[model samples]
Target: MKEISTLRLAKELERSERTIFTVKELTSQIKDLLENRFLLVWVEGEISQLKNHDSGHIFFSLKDEEALLKVIMFRERARELPFPLREGLQVLCFGRISVYPPRGEYRLIVQRIEPRGLGSLQLAFEALKRELAARGYFDEARKKSLPAYPERVAVVTSISGAALHDFLRVARERWQAEILIYPVRVQGEGAAEDIARAIDNLNRMKDLDLIVITRGGGSLEDLWAFNERIVAEAVFRSRIPVVSAVGHEVDYTICDFVADLRAPTPTAAAQQIFPDRKQLIEDLDFRRRRLFELISERLRKLERELHHLSKRLKSPEKLIQETGERVQDLEARLRKALAHQFFLKENRFRNLVRHLEAVSPLAVLSRGYSVTRKLPEKIVIRKAREVRTGEFVEILLEEGRLEARVERIHPDNHLF
Candidate 1:
């Protein structure tokens, strides 16, 4: 009876095969049936045989211990992956079935792929954080130091948020710095970009000493702007020192790591950056009082010293007597100096006079020598021939001048 049934089924199969469809038609029909039956289905499996093509399409196989399903995510859909795809990674995929007519194979057309244990956004955040950290963006060495006293502070936050109000309230009471608000979206789409742009714009102002980036506490999705790479990079590149005050004290974000300073809250940032005016006044008063006391003490000490010195001092008459005695002693020294100088000058003068007397011609004349000169010519008779036998000559002697005639001219040829 089973063989007779099998034969009847075979004849029915042969009849259906006589009107068989082409490969394309068959694949299209199967694709349509499977896609329609499993539209927008969730599939959880481990990825295997993954291939990321140059065209940005990802082709892989999702498998389990029992079976495997071929998956293909096109470029447009694959671009939305928050994390990198790899073989043997367990994932949850949402897509519909699709067929390749040429290959006659049906594949799961994936729209989105997420890691099994973590949310997509969280995975993206971690991925971006790792990338930035590897590039030294989160290095503490790159961070700038905040000004000791910032006079102009720029607050980048949502104008409608309570953060601004809290910051302003604390700032106004604490310090006299001018607050400039750069209003931007703190949540939702484009919030990260808005924050980055605001930071860049605030940096263009040379007068801005501090940039405080802040937002109120919220869910991870709402606080994602502070975690974005755009905002982190902006904080890192800012010329002015940046202060990140986002969410509550327990919260942390990428901006907090890259910023020059990280405050727990907006109010905390205000208090940390600004000095308390009352405390400053009190400190100034304390220092001023200290300085005045020191000066007064010094003056009092000087007065005491003066009094002590005055007590040890002599009377005016005694002072005058001492001064007079000093003057008399100085006068005696002056007279002694003058007498010594006069004795030295007298010796020098006497030596000069003796030298002059030794060189004088009258000294030679005193030794019985005379100077004779021919009369009328007044030439000195140095040679006998200088005077004729009858020429009158004058003889210069030590006592007087004598006039005489040349009586004899003795020829001294033999002596020459």
Candidate 2:
């Protein structure tokens, strides 16, 4: 009975050894079962231990109150997320279960993720808008003014879009200008990057006066490229003035806020940048007419003043003839006055000569009187005492003079 029992135990041991497996083989079997069973699934959890690698891969753990699951997003999937991932954020993830054979671990290979309540795209838009506002990207002072008359313009848009056609039509109607098309993708993956690169490239050219970034209306997802921070930064950094004409009037994007000017539509953007050609021509014509009117009025005023002056002016020949007649009259009057004056002067001269003769001693001498004076001194002798005895004396007449010696001196009775 003991020998039979030992042989039965040996058979049981051999069967058990045949079914046993190594650690790698057992893990591989578990991996195959989990992967096949959970090919695609939706897991809701709060993110934790989030690690974003420089290689563009994201590693994290999704945990709830009682359980936690390891998760990873490769670079290709990670870049598709519009909003940034943070710790403790409640998210819904769609992915397949994957096993790391080397570590004997299972994790979720996330294909897509979304925030629990608000849409991820909307959340991203709001978050980026706030960040850019804080950095002064939306400051009115920093915005450049669009040219009143844009001579050269560069448009960034898809060639096939209706936005380009609308803009071209409006611009052509309003003004004559050089339009440069800088074609780029308006929506889809890498659209934002493509737009930004186009903006940067257009800025390199020296001749562009303005940049117009335009696209037709679409859903939020379709219009998302304009809301990207990359595109906003490109608009902000541009030296050339930028106009954002991205959608219908109701839809607003980050690019609209950051651009120098925002238009309701592509047509409106063209209208704002270019002046009306016909109106400008009319204005120039009006100014020209006004200038001519002013010149005519000035000439007419000067002609009237010249006419008034001519009326006051005298003929030179007539003035000279009048002056000669007056001179002749003055000469005749002067001669008559001189003759009357000379006759009066001659009568006065004769009366003066008679008065001088009445008082002249020479006339008295001519009437037989003489004047005697002491000799040598020739002093007049008014009385006999003026001469001394034995002194020579002289006598004067009108025409002759005599000299004699005084024999004696005498005194008159009136002197006693």
Candidate 3:
């Protein structure tokens, strides 16, 4: 019965009219369908599992809460991105869907990409900020300090703009400095290069104390020149201190972070770099008064000390008389000390003389004792055997020395 059932199922399968397809054939059809259907479509989703390949291609998953799609950007398209693509970043991609035949999977072939909420300019700004920070371009240690009193300032801005006028007015009100207006476009094409060149030129000048890169407040698009990497690099490389006054207080740019100082506005920049002449004069006057007070107090203190010293001081004549009395006392004491020292020296001399006389050989010779020494050698004979027979000898008597011949050396026993 099982064989009959198998036979009947095989016959039914052969009779049925159904199309059969290989995996490759089916995948090719799907690839064509997806590529045609999704041509030039836009997709918005959060990025995930991002992979930046060494070949400059980027691969990632685009995911919404409900579904996930595989995405790919080739080297050429990826290179055009102003910012790096990262995981979890929401992005809008324009591409066509295509299927991989081997894996039987469909993915987006992205031709263009952008951050979801941020414009290209803002994306570029953030990207550059991170890069420059990593390069230490915004380090506090590298930023120069503004001079206390700037002697010469070079302003890089458009002369026709209100920013230049505002800066000049504030500068004139504050301090008298040499204002060198290096006019350059503050926005639009070629503005960043122009500003960078102006900075470099100002740095080459001999006596420029500060360089102010300023512009009137505007939208981010209108103020993009200051946000450029060229401007930031110029500000970083400048030998003279840089003041970035690009916009209103709320606006910020790359130049602001890299500059030595950031001022809210052009007018505020001038106020910051220049001293207030009126305030300085007031301060000098106050210091002069304080100095005068200090001098007067010091003189008073010295005068009081002098008066106290004068009261304790004796007259010259009285001082001389007392000095003479002291000299007389010192002279008497010196004479008494000298007499005592002489007496002690004389007693010491007498004792030394008596002791020397007791040990003198002349004293022994005068008491009938003689000293005999061999001639030529002059060796004193301590024993009778010390003298050689027939040798010449010197005999020291009480009054004089005599030369004699030694006839014999007597035995010591015979002498006893």
lDDT of 1 by residue, 1-416 (tens): 23568878789887845767887787788888887888888898988999999999999999999989999999987764545676667788988877777887777889877566536456666776787788898888988888878899999999999999999999999888889999999997678879999999998898789999999998777787787766887888898999999999998888888888899999999999998999999999999999999999999999999999999999999999999999999999999999999999999999999999998989999999999999988998888987789999999999999999989888686655
Between candidates 1 and 2, the TM-score winner:
1
* Candidate 2 per-residue C-alpha lDDT over 69-184 given as tens digits, one digit per residue, 9 for 90 to 100: 99999999886664578777778899999999989999999998766644655776787788788899999999998778888999999999999999999899989999999889
Overall local distance difference test of candidate 1: 0.87
* Deviation in Å, model 2, residue 76 alpha carbon: 13
Write the number of the candidate with greater lDDT, choosing between 1 and 3.
3
Residue 196: error of model 1 in Å? 1.8
lDDT of 3 by residue, 67-160 (tens): 9999999998876554567767787888988898878788999987655654655766788789888999899998888999988889999989
Winning model by TM-score: 3
Q: How well does each candidate superpose onto the true structure, as a TM-score?
A: 0.62, 0.55, 0.64
Pick out the ten consecutive residues of candidate 2 with the lowest summed lDDT: 114-123
lDDT of 2 at 410: 72
Q: How well does candidate 3 match the true structure in TM-score terms? A: 0.64
Off by over 4 Å in 1: 1-152, 160-162, 176-180, 204-209, 218-220, 312-321, 351-359, 373-394, 402-416
